[model samples]
Target: MAIMVRSWERLLLASIHDVSPRFESEVDSLRDLLSPHVGYRIAMLVVPNHWGNAPIVAGSPFASRLRDWADAGSEIFLHGFYHRDQARHQTRSARLKSRFMTGGEGEFLGLSLEEASVRIAEGRKVIEDITGRAVAGFIAPAWLYGPGALEALEEAQFALAEDHFRVWSPATRRKLASGPVITWASRTRARLASSLLAAGALRHAPLQTLRVGVHPPDVRHPLLIRSIEATFNHAARNRRAARYADLLD
Candidate 1:
């Protein structure tokens, strides 16, 4: 008797995080690299205001590009208003995660529900104003959010939200996918460690939905760039490339 194995259905979502005018050039380069493989299916996690400094305005070059991407089927997600942590420390664990895990990019961590709601609304408005389209979703910086962040996301009416491990609908509370993302770290040692971890995932995490998060800094490192490409190529063998919207569909 001949036996057949059914391959697991898997989804692959790629995203460029911390996108803002500050990293526009790097973001473009990464997009160029990704387009050939995934077309315009990648998502852009945009910072409406970067570090409470540079704000993305309507009719600007960046905003124009965002519209182009959105029209081309790339999703625009409202990342944190300021992709920098400014909330007061609420706990030792939160403080440690901010300082070490996120490198101070977890803007939502430790924020009160009201404060998080206000920021989420503000950021979403800026993106909607520029794109003239409703922002597709929201993803907190570094995939870290405060206790009230989820509540605020629901109140703000975002269709979707993502953490490090899963994507879920804020309104319906339906879990769309379960998978750990493969992403690069910043420093040299950390980058090397991430490369190994990502390689391990490629080798072992088959038959599961996978998310690959690409940051501007990852494009700067040659090794990390290779790792990102390799991961994509490996996933392409069996998994279908997808946008966040595809998951919801």
Candidate 2:
């Protein structure tokens, strides 16, 4: 029975991260590029106000597109409030994770429970207000969460939360799946090369589930764009695209 279940079919899940009114054009390009491979099955992680600037205003044009995206079956996730790190670093580990894991976009790092709750509640409300539907989950900016942020997610009862290593339910505290999230970086040459190489290797990896992530910068780099589509084509040959919410089913 285990073998039969495992043999049913592998699944591929993909997402567009750092989604905001700030990068609307890049987001649209990514959506158009990915539709052929994933067919709007990608999750969108939205920042309510990117860097305290590009807020998803109530009746803005971008907000309307967000609602349309949700209506078309793309899952949305509350990414962060400001999408910028402002909390004082209270520990050495927190400091290192913020510095090395991401630029300065780890907004949830070093947050107190109360602070994290405030951001989460408001961010969720903003997205829900714009989309007129519940978001699929909450994913911290740069996938870095301080302990307070993790607890706050559960307190608010978000259905799912994902990091680089796994996707899990914050409410139930259950890790539904464990796998690496394949993604590309375009800020530097070496990092971009390494990511492309990793994607090439992952194309043929034997796994029951594969997850890919795209950021707005990826659309601007031609080579990374090619690699993205290539990875999708090769991986999708065997695994069908699936939604994050489908994990519960």
Candidate 3:
């Protein structure tokens, strides 16, 4: 018998989500956890105004810190215009998803194309102004985009946009087929169970690309934090660190 070695490019896409003035400490803590162990660039999914409040003002200490991270080679992504759910759902299923699935936090769940465009543009500009850097990508909060999200994303001229399962080029609408992401939500028992199952499954799967999306509140739970650390260790075993922007290039 002979042994055969297979080689593939493995990428670890890690990000800290819901970044705003209110969640600064949590984001900072997540960054500290990722800085040494991941050995790759991480994406910071910043919300211009989170929950209709806690806006990121320009030239403030918070904005300055974001600039520092951008200078250090981390990619900054516009998460959402306002990370709050206000859209009215037309269908029962949609309403159920909005209220239960996301805990009423899917900001773009039912927006029209024109409205989505305006909000996305506003968020992009605000982030650019605050960070003094070009915002290259956008990711909807909770990985949920409404009817006009793609169109709005295209109009905003972001290089890339990501949903829960995959990343795509906004310009061409082409899917990258990267792989499913491993994410956690500690809001409920069902969410926790599903997230744990996904993490455990991906830990042993020999995949070419692995993404880990971390929410600011995730640090509050010790079990989630441990799972995050373990997932990073397992994924980093044979993967290189990468940013969503890198996927564009």
Candidate 4:
């Protein structure tokens, strides 16, 4: 019998939202954990506009460190214009309902094509300016995007778009790879459960690409951090680590 070995290129993508207190430490730990690997690359997703305020890019303490990471060859991606709900609903509950409906497309689905294009373009500019580097991709807030969002991405000239399950080409409009994704839930128990499930899957299947999604809050969990390190080591042994931009090449 052939020995089953999980083979997948590991790519870590982290989403950083409203300047949280834990942001600095989490970033430090992540950098320390992944820096030693020869080919490891991370995509740091930045939420430019949250709560419809001025772009929060400049005010973040970790912004400088993010730039350093990019300088070291990590890819930076624009997460979303705002990481919050911006819909026509009147009530708070209604607004929440609208935000995530249809995976967040509903919130911006009503936007005119021109309006959507404008928003995406503006966000792209802000992120690039802050990082002083070209952003390689766009991932919508909550990994939620409408069909129209793809068109907006193309107009803005983003090279990649990462959704909930797969990484897609904005130019070709097709999935490049699909396999296990490591994402955290709100609770510690849920986060642990998901990491265990992901690790188990990685051990069994022919996973071509391992996409690990992390949020700032998840760094607090010891198990989550351990799982991340273990996953990286596993990938280093079996597959090359790459950034989303590598798919283009």
Superposed by TM-score, candidate 3 places the C-alpha of residue 9 at a distance from the truth, in angstroms, of: 0.7
| TM-score, one value per model | 0.92, 0.95, 0.92, 0.74
User: Which candidate, 1 or 4, would have the higher lDDT against the true structure?
Assistant: 1
Give each model's whole-structure lDDT.
0.82, 0.88, 0.81, 0.61
Look at candidate 4 and tell me the lDDT of residue 129.
Answer: 74
| TM-score of candidate 4 against the unseen true structure | 0.74
Steric clash pairs (candidate 4): none
Model 4 agreement with the true structure over 62-99: per-residue lDDT tens digits:
55666666687767777666655455544565456454
What is candidate 3's lDDT per residue for 140-225, written digit by digit as tens?
Answer: 98888877877788877677888877888887888753667788888888888788888888777766668888988888888888
lDDT of 1 by residue, 70-95 (tens): 87878899989998888788799999
lDDT of 2 by residue, 1-249 (tens): 011224467888889988998899999899998999889787999999999988889999989999999998899999989989988898999999998888888999889999999999999899998999988899999889999998899999888999988999998988877778888987789888999999888777777778899999999899999999998888877888888887765
Pairing residues by index, what is the TM-score of model 1? 0.92
Which regions of candidate 2 deviate over 4 angstroms? Answer: 1-7
Whose lDDT is higher: candidate 2's or candidate 4's?
Answer: 2
Q: After superposition, how far is residue 66 of candidate 3 from its true place, in Å?
A: 1.0
lDDT of 1 at 226: 76
Error of 2 at 177 (Å): 1.1
Candidate 2 residue 244 Cα shift, in angstroms, is 0.4
Candidate 2's error at 187, in angstroms? 1.4
lDDT of 3 at 158: 75
Query: Which portions of model 3 miss their true places by more than 4 Å?
Result: 1-7
